[model samples]
Structure formats: structure tokens, C-alpha cells
Target: MQRGLSGQYEIGSVVGQEEVRAFVPAPLPPDPLPDLAGERGRLHEQALLACGRLDAITALLPEPDLFLYAYVRKEALVSSQIEGTQSSLSDLLLFELEETPGVPFDDVVEVSNYIAALEHGLGRLREGFPLSNRLLREIHERLLARGRGAERQPGSLRRTQNWIGGTRPGNAHFVPPPPQRVESQMADLERFLHDDQQPFSALIKAALAHVQFETIHPFLDGNGRMGRLLIALILHEDRVLHQPLLYLSLYFKQNREEYYRLLDATRREGDWEAWLDFFLEGVLTTANGAVETAHRLLDVFREDREQVEGTGRSAANALRVFHALGTRPVASINDLAERSGVAYPTASRAVEALEGLGILREITGRRRDRVFAYWRYIAVLNEGAEPL
Candidate 1:
């Protein structure tokens, strides 16, 4: 964009326009990420140790339940990301919402879809399938679906140029790598993705790739969400984890300022270690948390079953109602009817049995318009029930 002396606006090539701040590639200094001294001095070791622990967790994956571990981890992530806001860890995990962040439901679903597509793409990358613009575009388009980035055709490259680091027209923070640099940066990163010996650990490689993507800031928007998703994708593709379930949004949401600052420090100063350590630690911590959560859910399911099984109602149907509670906590009898796939009277009987077992609490008192809740199960899923 060209600015007239009187503040008029014009567009032209930055190359020819002296007034435009033409982006020139600067010689990035050596990796200073190692200098993440005090807090994460032992981060490299911690990351490796965490990898070992997570590997053991994966090994515990029995044949039938191998994907179960992956699937539930995926559920935790999807539930959090789809219904979460840029807020507290408690809120993200519990999905507690007293006041809606006003994020549209469509945007939520779109981001979740992108997460799924990235999972698919990462699967291909793991098997040595070549990544193509078409695949990337398809994933990117799906990410943009029904959301803010819908301005552009889904997955189509911009016919016009795009830039970042600018806030207002008059003063922008940083210009993205110029157009010419985009192809090279992308290619180099892709090579790094395939490189077996990059003189760095997988943890470091994850950091480098993340920072590089953000620096490239390739897309118009959804870059932050996409970059985070890529962290999980890389971890899964490299066999660091058996599933693309590791997530850092919880950590990033917690330490948002530091996250941005360390990323910027990479460009302005070269603090690669700091960022890498953070990323690595996030993987381990999030992985452990996920494992614990899955086990907790299993325990909850077992206990709930023992409490309500053989209530003279259909034992399997009662169990189904409990499972449905995991998905919809505040459910009406009609909701139970749909989920249980039983007749209305049968569903009502099942709900009554659960209520007698204290498994469900009635929310609304109207006899006809009654609503029963799986209060305990929801409480287990949400640390504190605020709202969905």
C-alpha cells in the first residue's frame, strides 16, 4: 500500500515505490533459543524425559484400545478448542462460560474442522506423502469455512498480495517476508520437515517450524490457530506421539504474553531455546494432563455404571444415557429420547431410574417441560459448571 503525502491511499509494488517499506530479508542471528537459561535451563532434558514418558503412555495403548487413547485425547482437544475462548485454563478444560465471549458458533465449528483437516494432512506427512498446495489449500479452506477468513475463496491463493506486521496504515509493527521470500521460506521449512538430521532435537524443530510459520505469517488470518494446530501435527507426524492430540492452547492461553514475546524475540533477538523449551514443556505437560483426564473419565464411567446398572430398566440403555450425559449435560427428556433411541415412555423410565439413583438432578421444575441433568457427570467433565 502506498500512502500519499496528504494521507491518500494507493497500491503498487513495494519494489519500485521508494516510499513503501520494502521488506528485505535480514540475516537472522544464530539460535539464541539455547539462552532460555533460568526457567528452562533443564528444558532440553525435561523435553526428552517427557517424550519418554509420553512414549510409555503410548505403549500402554493395547491393540483394541490403541486408538481409544488417541480418540479421547482428540475429544478433549475438540471439546476445548471448539467451545473454548481465549481465557483461563479452567475455562478451556471445563468449558465454563458465564458470559459468552460472543464468538459465533460457526467460527467454533470451522476451527474444529480445520483441526480435523490438519490431522488428516499430518497423517499423509507421516507416511511420506508429498505435501502439495492443493492439500494445504484444501485444509486451509476448510479452516476458513463459515468464518472470518471466508472473505477469500476457500483454499485459493490470493491473487493480490498480503502482508503482516502492520497495525494501522501509517505505522505497522513488522512487514511479512516479502512476496519473493514466501516461496523460499516455505520450501526451506518443508525441507526441514523431511530432514532427518537438522542438528536439533524434535522439540527444537517444533519450535523452529512454529516460529518460521508465524514469521512467514503465510495466511491472511487463522495463522495463530493454524500454527498451534501445526505443533500437534508435527508431533504426530514425527511419531513423537501416536495421535495428533497434544495441544498448547491451554498453555498459550495461560501465558499468552510470554508466548507472543518469545516468538517476537526470535526475530528481534534470537531466543530459539526459550521458545523451544516452552513448546517442549507444553507437549509433556499437556500430554500428562490428557492421560490423567482420560483415566478420570474412565473411572467416572465405571463408577456411574456400577451405580445405575440393572435398575430393572434396560441396563444398556441406562448406560447409554450416562454416555449421552458426557456430550449433553443439560438434557431434556426429548434429548434423552433421541439419544437413547427408545420410545418416550421408555426414555422417561430410564431418566426416572437415574434420578432415583441420584445420577441426574432436575433443573427445571415444570412437570411437563421438565429438564433433567447429569449433574455429577457434567461436574466431572467441567471443573465447575458455568455453561457449555
Candidate 2:
């Protein structure tokens, strides 16, 4: 049966709020992570295999697909992040496009806008910008660049209280420390980012940061998604992984329940090892998945290039034509015109050229309106994954 999410606004399916402030959550407990999480032997073996496999394939690949991987993953993370009172795992996938029956859609366009900004921020990070609250605030602010919440540009720090879960007005599943507590939370967060006090490995540190930040719930919105992206950022910053091609969302989405449970458990039990192991497992799984995606993408690129080039296009034009692979993976003829910055006739000629050579596959049979797909590459992106 389909989910009955007929309501129009997002609220915690599990967490509740008493009007955002004056919220009270469950009792907090000490750390509960085991030193090795008992499942160590098998998990260790899997980790070794995962690391070796990912590194081997990644060694052959060059840059991150800034257009495909980073951008799409950012979109998923950001949508899942703030979604304020209503966001859910399933909602992340549809937030920007086709409204689903029984599911609410609001500020959809804004999600894309912020995702673009997220891409911009990631670009800056790769360029060596220092990470700071000001930087993050800027990203959140731009997230409102379009859509319903555009006026919510003051996406700045929260001055009021926010809660994670519950139904009663004053009760929440989780609540951040407080407005005054932001600074201390920031300090801890910053130190974790830059400090050498590796109470554990890079994998473990990543988990610790995630749990701590969620515990802090720094912003009134976007905390969950931002926290997830921050994981990839940390890995890249620390050189734990190359090229942020990871789709940690895939793992978390599959293990959604445990993901939240362990996050909550960290606060209740201080089970650092449990969370660390979980995070590592996610890393191992996603890293391997990403490698497969990369190879699949490369194959599609090569094949698409062949088809476009067979039309006798210049080598340089071949580069531009191959762009159809990622630029607008789903392009209408109009999209083709806008993207290539060409007149309708010129765009038509180009599409016909590729189509004749079997590069761009038409999706719709309609004459008046049509859509074309760079199926090979898109298939790779959409492979093994449903919407977030």
C-alpha cells in the first residue's frame, strides 16, 4: 500500500514540537559505544575489502563529477536537512519536482536553489576556504534564493529553541542545547573538524562529529541534511576519501531506522563505538557503490562519444556533445536550446545529429512536445537508487 502522507506540511513522524521553543526531550545518558562493537571481526574483514576495492577503482578515476555526484548528493542532503517540520526520506527525492499524491510539496524550487549554493560552497571548500559558521550561514541563506521561503533569507542562526521529535507542544524527541549554547557547540564542532584529538580513527571521528552536531542541532532547520553533507566534507578535508563521490544518503536511506536510532543512542548511551561502526559500514558500502557508479558513467561517456563522433563532428564538438551526458541529464528540446545557447533550428539540428547517430534517445513520441534522455549516464545515477 502507498503511504498516506496526504497532509500538506512536514512534521516529525517521530519527533514532535511544542511550538519550537520551551521544548523538552527524553532523558540524556552517557556514551554507549563499545570499544569494538563486538561485530568487529567480520566488519573488519569487510572494511579491508571495501577499502581495497574502492581505492583500486578510485586510483583510476580523476575528478569528482561536480555536475552529477556532488550536485545531486548535495540536493539530497539539503532537502533531507532542513525540511523544517515536514521533511522525510521519501520527500527529499520529490521536493523539487512532480508532486506525489498523498505527499506535500512546498518550497520545492528553493530546494534546488540551495542545492546549487551547496555546490558553490563545496566548490569553495575544494578551493581551500576555511570552514566557519559564517560560511554555513551563507549557504543556508542562499538556499532561499528561490521558492516559498525566499523571505526566510535570514536563514541565519536560530535565536529561538527547536526540537527534534514528539507530539506535545512542549515535548520533543530531541532539542539543541539553547541559543546561548550555540557558541560552545560551535567550539566543539570546530575543534572536531580541525583538532588532532582523534579519540579514534578518521572513520570514528566522522561518526562522533555527526552525533555531536545533531545533538547540537545548530540551526533551527537544515540540521539533518547539513550534518550529513558535513560528513562528506570532513572526509574530503581529512583526506579519508578522494573526490566526495560518495552517496552516504544511499546507505542511510536503506538503514534509515537504525541511522536515527543509533544517532539517538549516542546521546542516550554515549555508544561512540556503535555509531562509529555504523558510520564505517556506511562508508564502506557507499565507497564501493560509488566506484561502480564511476565505471558505469565512464562506459556511458565513451559509448555516447562514439555515437556523437560517428556523425563526423569535430573532436572539440564531441566534448560539447558529450556534455549532454550530465549537463541536463533530462533535457527537453528547449532545454537543449537554452543549454547550448543556440537558436531553435540549430538546437534541432544538433539533436537530430546526435539522434541519427543514436546518442540522445527521445523519451516522448509526441511531436508537439518531446523529451530526450542521455540514458546511459542517467541510468548510472539512478541505478541501485530510488529517490532519496
lDDT of 1 by residue, 220-336 (tens): 656666676667666666677665546666667667678878877766555566667677777668767756755666566568778877665477777776666655556677777
What does the lDDT read for residue 208 in candidate 2? 69
lDDT, candidate 2, 194-253, per-residue tens: 767544555556666777667767676666666776776666666665555554766776
- The 10-residue segment of model 2 with minimum total lDDT is 1-10
Residue 297 C-alpha lDDT in model 2? 69
Q: Which portions of model 2 show Cα errors greater than 4 Å?
A: 1-107, 148-155, 307-323, 332-347, 356-359, 362-371
What TM-score goes with each of the models?
0.72, 0.72
What are the C-alpha RMSDs, in order, of all predicted structures? 7.1, 8.3
